[model samples]
Target: MKPTLNEQLRQNIRFTYNEALELIVAMGMAACGEQMYAMAQDYKIEMDPMADSFYEDTKARLSPHTFRELQFFFGHNFLHKTLDFGFYVSICSNPEPQSADDWIRSLEAVPAEWMLTEMVFGVYHDKLEELLQGRDWEASKGNLSLLAALVRDTPPHQEVIHTQEPLLECLAHPEECKLRYMQLLSQFYKDVFIRWKEPLKERSEQASAHYETLFAAKPEQFIREIHKNEPEIFISFPAAFHVSQASQVGNHFLNFTTAAGNVGWVIFGIHNERVFGPAADREQTELFLKAFSDKRRLDFVLLLKERPHYGQEIASALGITPAAVNYHSNFLFFLDLISVKREDHRMYYHLNVERLRELLALTAKVMLD
Candidate 1:
């Protein structure tokens, strides 16, 4: 018999531990690389094969340094990509499935580009719902403002507004107006914008200080620097770099020499987070760093980790009210950290244990030291 979805996912995780890590890292860095590429594309910035060439040349010249930067870049990028994809998968795969084929088909059908777009829309929808429910939009106005700025920066936003002006004008009431505008606006920018843009923007703002510390002239320089400074660090390469040479070829060399083990690759590019299993292995390295952070809400994760328990069981275990647990659990489930199994009258929770273990190990190594 074929493996169950959970079982299959576990096997995949175990089988490709290094690859999975690589994918997570790749996903994270790609989030930045892709975002930069999109922005460059929008500005018609002459597509330099140099970035790819530089990356390769640097890797070859300074493999160590390039590796470390790649790893840092990947870690930073993975978390955002994972959470974004996780949320998208959760919403798209509603009303949990009973058969493996149904679930597999569901996974296969997820359009990565659309998934990212919908996730942005979902965030806007939730914010609008919150505003409608008496929450203050002004309190979170900074975020709203940023969203607006992101829309303005991307060319697609202008196109979306031009095309969707009618829809925006139709929902002109105060309660719905902002959201409608954001919804329409996000649609246009989604293709060009990545979830990691916010973090990258923050990083870019502090570029002069952080760049020398984080990025390398070559891959070997990255590895050697990490060996001298942060000996425990693990780094991975982006698939794009494997194909480019914008950096000095030697600078891009990777040093996987740490006694604690080195970074891994996720391989695939942007993908749907909900599509769990070996197939989802490509470019998922971004998840390792993002999921490791405390921002992921531990209680929900604990509930999922414990067992395939029902709502009340999860609530009781976490020492919270059922309604609260339901809200949080739903969010975690939405994030793809947990899965729901409905049996007749109730739903049970199952955590993605293998992924959890991988994340935990990486986090312990990176942060604990």
Candidate 2:
């Protein structure tokens, strides 16, 4: 018999203080952390000043060419498909220590086809096999039109188009891309992350121990708390859950990927949000109201009421840019009134209608009584 989600989680989930893997993610973020903060500021969200200083120092450590290469490879938002490669490396190097040299060697051993597929389409899926059955990676390397065709089939397509240039560049010169990646990792790790290695390792261990205690006591609740934005996955376990070092100060970075097997893998973030599943309190109610009070955000929810929309579509409808939509969406996400879905290798924003109705009833009761 197949195991239940809880059993699978208990059996498959592995948490550790992998310095090498964390460095991969940290370097990727360092590549684009300043840009991320600027985008946040555009939406009126203030980030930690120390994170700003950290990113500035990281930028100073890189040569001009290397810095551009890092941004080109990772993208400005650090959401490039290739970033998933770090997690893939961790998955392979588990139960054994991983080193920086091991990371580059792993990249050398990976097939060009595997790297290209992951880059073109954010994550690999069997359906992609059917889509590109006859076309080989070498042939598709410089084919911009092929990317358009694939993106068209995927819902919420515009965002994927934003990544086409970097994806194509990586495909065209896979070896150069690997070399640049290796250089960025080696240089950044040596200059910036080496001192950080031990401190981050200690934090990861402490966080892992804390989460393990909560998870062993109440598995579902623990998952819900960590995934405050999308609470349903606890009911159906994903590929695996990983705990890693914090990339930015004060804000935990969470990334979800579907690796080679079509199973979901999530790099769980630090637990920082207030628990949302328990009975709603006065503070929670006020938080919900503050979220809805924004006219644009209210409009966003109303648009979702008509049907789920992706970031690009929502931005277009609201006369705002995609970055603005992202900021407003973050608030809606934390409130649990919306959840994210991945379909056809792209992301779509979904409304939790039941959660919305629950809030309405609660608000009405409070006002009338």
> What TM-score, computed on C-alpha atoms, does each candidate reach?
0.25, 0.60
**For candidate 2, lDDT tens digit of each residue in 1-369?**
987655655664545555556666666667667665664554334544544555777778778877776666665345434434543443433443466556656666666545555565553332455446567755665454575465345432344345545655665666776666667767777777776677667766776687677666666555654444333443343334445544432222233433433334455544332223233344557778899888999999999999988889899999999999999999887778998898877688999999998778766655674
Q: Please, what's the RMSD in Å of model 2?
A: 9.7
lDDT of 1: 0.36
Per-residue alpha-carbon lDDT of candidate 1 for residues 1-369, written as tens digits (9 for 90 to 100): 975433332222211112212222323333345454554443323334534433343344433533443333222222233223332233223321122223333434444334333333433442344323454544534343333433333323322223122222222222343333233223212322233334323322342233233333333332233212231233221111111111111112222223443322222211111222222232233444444354435766765565677878766766778887666655454335677788878877788887677656544644553
Lowest-sum lDDT 10-residue window in model 2: 248-257
Q: Which prediction has the highest TM-score against the true structure? A: 2
The parts of candidate 2 lying over 4 Å away from their true place are 1-8, 38-53, 79-97, 111-113, 123-156, 228-240, 247-265, 271-283, 289-355, 358-369
Q: What is the C-alpha lDDT of each candidate?
A: 0.36, 0.60
Cα error of candidate 1 at position 60, Å = 44
Evaluate residue 17 in candidate 2 and report its C-alpha lDDT on the 0 to 100 scale.
52
